[model samples]
Target: MAAAGVSLGATVLCLLAWAGLAAADRVYIHPFHLLVYSKSSCEQLEKSSAETPKALTFTPVPIQAKTSPVDEEALREQLALATEKLQEDDRMRAAKVGMMLNFLGFHMYRMLSESCSTASGTVLSPTTLFGTLASLYLGALDPTASRLQAFLGVPGEDQGCTSRLDGHKVLSALHTIQGLLVAQGGAGGQSTLLLSTVLGLFTAPGLRLKQPFVRGLAPFAPVTLPRSLDLSTDPDLAAEKINRFMQAVTGWKMDRPVSGVSPDSTLLFNTYVHFQGKLKGFSLLPGLQDFWVDNATSVSVPMISGTGTFQHWSDAQNNLSLTRVPLSKNACLLLVQPHGASDLQQVEALTFQHNFLTWLKNLSPRAIRLTMPQLTLRASYDLQDLLAQAKLPTLLGAEANLGKISEDNLRVGKVLNSILLELKADEGEQPTESAPQPDGPLEVTLSRPFLFAIYEQDSTALHFLGRVANPLSTV
Candidate 1:
């Protein structure tokens, strides 16, 4: 009986030991516990263990215990504080950007103006005068009526001071500048700088002929004319003289006006030529002729056949056909023409076809196309070329003083630089809290580059002028 009792106790002890070992293995030798276990059996034990209940699948039962609710007012206050901080940061960033843009623009304008002035002086040099003259003559031969009228005297009894040769050249320069602004795709400030530069050139004495000579005499001195020659009777001589003058001024063969209405019919229609000569002391030559030509044209054409008028437009399809004819081998000219049509679409199409439009679609106001027979043409020119041609004489002789030109250039440059700096500074300055933001995913900061242009709402007459953030430095 004693031996049997001892055997039973030993068996119970062995069973308890086995159970304890199993429990320990389950608790401490789990897959996640292998690192803490002894290397001898931990890895094998972990591999044999069952996977634990995933936390994602373990939904807790609701507890009866009560908890405090979040404070809505306090949460709102915290959010407001965070928003304010974000806004402050944005404001600082904006201000800095604005200042930098303004500075850059101003300096760029100054540089362009200075360079233009310097170029004007150099182009007017005696060595360069002949080339300049050649360019102007070639430019006059362009098919566009507005350009032709600008270079040559307007034909009519109403011809006044504006019809004078000098006045025509000035107008041509202005038109040229307008075209250039359109072609170059820049802010109106560039055009303004160009305008100012040309005006300065006009005032410079180097451009004006010092000795007054007969207009038609120098070229045709060998050919004698009858004292009382009738213009109608001497059509040949008149034509020859006109041809010589044109050749001397511009180096291209002159095409006689086609016997139909002038191709510049739109430009000349109901147009009044206004003349304002120099204002006393301001005159380059004391009675130097100043002419202002203004006109309005209206046309009604079939919708399918596009018809309208615009100062400038672009043509993507006919890019190769578009060409830049020099106003002078050395000068600049301004040219303007009126475009008209029954509606916007037709006019735009025509302008596009002719390559008169600027690349900037947003800034383009309108397009003009005229229907004259089978031909369609767009009016365009280089402002600098026009000015160079008009101011060609100024580049010649001792009168082409570098110091005066440099001073003028610097003054213009400073003004442009200041403007740019102010604009950039404004951009850099933080926006006030009171300033409202636009409600859109695409926010347009007023600080971004912008362009402005003027248009006569009733007509295709577009005068583009404005500031841009960063004008590329290609020019």
Candidate 2:
């Protein structure tokens, strides 16, 4: 995929050089003294090599975007040239996003997952997190965009005037899936699925965000807010004020808000996802069900069980089992739990895996009486911490040129992602939860910790991911 990006960038660079539209970035070609041809011959060869291409293509090339005060025209032309490539790249965008998000998800989740190792579950929305960074990429220049493009699994664009695989395209692709989930939020049953998200941009009172950057975030339904913060004078106080703002917006769904706002920071980014899943014909166990909170301890919690034909598989070598149940027209609730003596941690090490879905493609439906805990969770993270954990601490570093984000020198404040997930029974369909159990189906119970991910059926995007240890705790 990166090869495609490099090729596209190189192609555009080659075209621009041929037309004399690019001057800032150059490839110096020189014929030297000894191994090279004589000076006279070298001069003639260079002239012909440079002029031959322009001669072959009679069409006069227009000025590129970066060379002028207005960049829209250049970007549009670039997009036009890459239409075929963009279409092909768009087809694989979801898979690309999934692989990249999960890869980042695994590393990011490792730290917080372990922090909640002995507690309840931890939840996260890969799309929400990825979108925020992608938005920043919209405003970023060169090196910063270059670093983030790899993290985002997006290709590089022409510089001075850069590439056309704009951050907006990636964010829009994700928003399209989100739109599908919201539209397909099926009617009441034991499991009804609904998903929605919002982005909050809090900036220092006087800083101005770039038009393109602001426009790029419109699809994500961002709420713009300018707040007065003496960031440089008192960063800690500024952090607290921003934290309060987020708490009010999220209704305190997240704890601690986000800490460590740089003193020079002019803005902060936050996004939240709300998801509710209720399954039909799945009812609570006769009584409180016992759960193994850890290897050495156990607690009783409300549990639900249902008998049905569902896709099921296992990695016996890893003592893990996966059960996929449909939630809505465009989504499914995927459950992964440890079997026998295997711990949830081992299963955590496996969820959001690259080939896991490839393996799931071959899942054979089977009859099983599956029992899972009543789930209610809220998981939160500081995005900067995730970058640091991924060993790319320089992403939002000082050298980053985020001109599109704001005109002022901005310091990024709390980059937070908070996700809320609740599994419940539909109020109107309460009685349907009591359908007769199958006489001889296999009994599979999640009376212990387990890992889970929600998939958007159409796009096959990993919407939300987490591990549940205790049904009650909000991570």
Candidate 1 matches the true fold with a TM-score of 0.18
RMSD of candidate 1 to the truth, in angstroms, is: 40.7
Q: Model 1: per-residue lDDT, tens digit, 1-475? A: 2332242334334323532353554453221111112354435545654553221211111121222332323322332232223334233322222222222222222323334421111011111111122223222222222232222212212223222223222222322322222221123211111110100011111112111111211121111111111123344553344334323422322233111222111100000000111111110112212111112322221111121222233343432111111111111111111221122223223332222324323232222221111111111122233334333222221232222122221100000000010011111212112223254121111111222222212112232212221222111
What is the C-alpha local distance difference test score of each model? Answer: 0.22, 0.60
In candidate 2, what are the lDDT values of residues 1-475, reduced to their tens digit?
Answer: 2432452344334333533432336763221111123446546756887876421111111111111122322322332233223344354444445444554554455656665544666787766777778778777766777777656643333332223235665665655555545443334411255554556566665666655566667655434333455556776776676666655544535553556667666666777666777776677667787788767888778888776777888787778888887666557788887885455665566655444566677576777777888877877788777676556566786667776666577677667787777786543342222235456666778877778888776556677788777776667
Candidate 2 versus the native: TM-score? 0.72
lDDT winner: 2
* Superposition error at 162 for model 1 (Å): 9.8
Per-residue error for 131 in candidate 1, Å, reads: 22
TM-score of each: 0.18, 0.72
Q: Where's the lowest-lDDT run of ten residues in candidate 1?
A: 413-422
Error of 1 at 9 (Å): 99
Best TM-score among the predictions, by candidate number: 2
